[model samples]
Each structure stands twice: as structure tokens, then as C-alpha cells.
Target: MQAWQGIDEFVSVVEQGSFTKAGQQLQVSTAHVSRSINALEKRLAVKLLHRSTRQVSTTATGQIYYQQCRQLLDGLLDANRTVNQLNTTPSGLIKITAPIYYGERIIAPLFNRLLQQYPDIELDLQLSNHNVELISEGFDLAIRLGSLADSSLMARRIGSRHFDVVASKSYFARCGQPHTIDELNQHNCLRGISDHWHFDVDGRRKDLRIHGSWRCNSGLAVARAAMDGIGIAQLPHYYTDNAVEDGRLMRVLEQHRPHSEGIWAVYPQNRHLSTKLRVVIDFLAAELGEQR
Candidate 1:
């Protein structure tokens, strides 16, 4: 008699293809299943099924009704599961990987706070420039910077970063500032890890191959060199913000600075994400989003 009555029995009958099978699935008698469908059809004012001794099948209207009922049932199950999961306490070891400098300066501190809040959680942090295989290496999460390559791994953008083309005040005074990307060829450009410098030329990303007397694999080393009047260098804001603010270094070619790129939290794809890992990612997104 209720509006919600008979939807389950009707859907089960259509899926099982017979009243007896539907009764077996729902743990009710075939007569009960038939009565429920009959009541449902009468309430809806439609002939919902074609009954025959060999098999039972839905009418055209019943087919449409079954589809809608199935979706509603699925949504109800999901809602119940979400409510149950809300009560689950996060407790587990989470393995994470990140680049060396950023990991130490940014991610490590945020995780330290997370551990303080959840004492049961444990962390295994790996700091390396090399991108490791997440699934094979057993990492639960990775903090990745800039543009990500095409990957099967899932990613969430936590924050953003932009490059700063900087030189020491003394270096700029002696060598002059590069007002345009082409002028970089004339100045002594310090190279870090790669000889290609990134910039924006007329609203398009441009990677300019640079020649420099100074080269270093460490960004900190390159930043220090630029501060000591070595040459101009391109580095992220974290590397140069303090120096630039304190008048130790100067930013040039502001018009050519590339658009800010994403800082991402990446993890392997899974059907169900665990509570601990989910908590960690949410914490990172909240903390880093504030910083930006």
C-alpha cells in the first residue's frame, strides 16, 4: 500500500526473469512476489509484466521503471555505506614520496602536524628527485610539482607555483638586466639541472635553451650562486622569495614569466580509497590551499 512498496520485488523479478527466481533472491514465496508486483502495477495503473508458464518478462513501461528503481537502490546503498565509513577511525602507515627540497621545506612540516593530530598514523617519507613507480614501490601518495606527464595515476591539484627569473642586485648592475627573453642569450645565465629555461612569450609557453658559465644540479646552489652575483637564474618562488623580498635579488622580464603551474597530490587509482590516505590528502589540500 505504501508508495515505496513493490519496487524491490518488481526490479528483482525483471532481473531474475521469473517469479520463482525473484522469490528465491528476495527470500520470499513466489506468491508473495507476484502479489507485490500486482499491487505495484495496479497502483501505477499499468500492466507491468507479461506472465507465461515458461518465463516472465517486463512490459515496456516496466523496463523503464526497473531502470529508475535500480539507480535509486544503488544510490541508497552508497549513502548508507558513506554514513558507515564516516565513523571509521584513520589508523595506518602511509608511504609517501616527494622531491627533495620541496619535501623537506613544505610537505614534511604539514605531515608532522597531521601526525600530531592523529597519533595512530605512521609515515614513511621518501625524498628524491626521481619519480618512482607508486604501485611497485608501495607508495601510498606522492607530492608532485609542475605539469604532470601522461599517467594512469590519479592526481588532485593542491596548490600552484610559478618561476622567478632572478639575479643579484650587483650582478644586474654589472651585466644589465634582460628585459626580453632574447636578451637572456647575452647575460650570463646560471643553469640548474637543465640548460633550458622556461618562460612565456606572447601568452605561449617557451623553453629557451641557455648557455651559462655556471651549472649546478641543486636549486639551492643555483639560488646561492645568483645571490653571490654569478648570473641570472630561473627558480621557483620557494627558492627565491626571501631573497627577492629582502632586496638581495631582483626579478626581471616580469612580462615573460610563465603562468603558474599546479602542485599536485598524486596516488594510484583504486575503487575504494582507504580512510588514512584519504585523511592525509584532505589535510594536504586544506593546508596548501591556504598557503596559495
Candidate 2:
């Protein structure tokens, strides 16, 4: 440990740009910080710093040394955290983000049950339709729906959902049920956030560019319009499932039903997850039904 004694102090001095700041951060005297770094340099037999009146900088060798030291320090921190987390229960303020509708309808209810079980765990959940930067925005987790694009964060599939091409039974009675993909263009389609609707043509996925008199960004609103006999709308299962079951809306284009997309819980890349995040994600994966 002798060689490691001043290693951290040296890293802090280089990173913090001054011995005084490093000492303040480490809660040691500036003199002690300087002495330890000087001792490390002597022990290593290398000049590690380029010191001036106003600033302290790393030498070329020091930069390489700093990189290695940083990895070692980070590894040590992660090891300590892992050991501590192992002994502890899932208790912490969990900050997360999810889509507005899903958060209100699904995540909120499921997390409420989790709160009932782990009363010590606190929640700071933000509901939004927009994508947020997890690390920069300080979110511990995110519940994202649909196929994810290439990203740096780690993701676990919790569930899946599909679009139900649906309309009111009355509307189907008047217009007649269209049986094929090309027939969709002949009908009045209620649009959602995207005018492009997705479908499964044979085994491959296809996007249907649609147009209509009734259009809205919210799936709930789009479903409501379909119920009111406005037009056929492709709505998410979560929004339309109850109505479909209750006979308020009739599912059309059963053969062209788009492939179910995955629901995911994403988090920052860490060596190991804290118990709170792990348990919640597991609960979601187990409790949230698949292949909707």
C-alpha cells in the first residue's frame, strides 16, 4: 500500500488543478497533500507534475500515470460500493423517467405497489413523452417502449405492446371491414403523432403512410375518435385493450397486426446495479404481462 499511499492525492491534485483544492476535497492539509505527492514522485522515480505560480499540470508521463491511476481508483470505488450494496436493502431515492401515458396508467400503479412493499424507498418519477438524457439529467432508470435505437445505456426488456388497428362496431357496419393492407388507404384513418403507421406484411415490418381528417398526438384521443365513429385508428394496446374487450371498439386487420415492440427499462452503464434499481426492474419484468 506504500506505493498507493500518495497515488490518489496525486490524481486529485492533477484533476483539481491545485494542491489546495485537492486537499480541501480530501479533507487534508495542503502541506500534507504536497508532501504525499512529492513522496510518490520520489518513490516512482519520475517527474509527475509541471508546477507554476498559478497552476499545476501533469507531465507527459504523468498523463499516462493519471489514466492508470484513475482506472484503479474507479475500480476501488466500484468494489466498495458493490460490497456495501450487498449488505443493504433496496432503500434510496429512485429517480426515473417514463412516457406520460404509460407512466400514469401502468408504471405509477406498479410502482405504488412496490412502495407498499419497500416503504423506505423513495421515488422521483418524471413522466414525459420526450426522450431524456439519463446520465446528464440524473435519472437512475427509464422505462421506454418500442424498439430502441442504438444507444450507450444498458436496457432490459420488461414487456411488449402492439398496435391494434381498430374502429367502432357501428363504423365497421357502415364502411364494411377492410381485410387487407392496401385496403387501409381506401378507408379514413385517424392519425397519431406520426402519419406513418406500422404493420406486419407477411413476416417483414412495413410502414403505411396514412392521411385522415381526424389527427392527434395522443393515443387516447385517437382511440376516442375511433369510438365516436370518426375513422379507423391504429392505437396502442394499453390505450385500446379495455375498449376492445368491452365491445366498444372492434379490432380490424387481424392479419396485418404489426409485430409487438418491446418495453424496456434502461439505465446508465455501471459495473453493478444498486438493489433498488435491480428489484424494481425485476418486478416490472415479472409483473408486466408480455405480448400484448
What is the TM-score of each predicted model, taking all chains together?
A: 0.80, 0.72
Whole-structure CA lDDT of model 1: 0.91
TM-score attained by model 2: 0.72
Clashing pairs in 2: none
Q: Tell me the tens digit of each residue's lDDT in model 1 across 73-112.
A: 8888777777766788888899999999999989999989
lDDT of each: 0.91, 0.91
lDDT of 2 by residue, 27-61 (tens): 99999999999999999999999989899999999
* Deviation (Å) of 292 in candidate 2: 2.9
Candidate 1's C-alpha runs over 4 A off are 1-3, 13-30, 45-64, 135-138, 150-153, 193-195, 201-206, 245-248, 269-273
lDDT value for model 2: 0.91
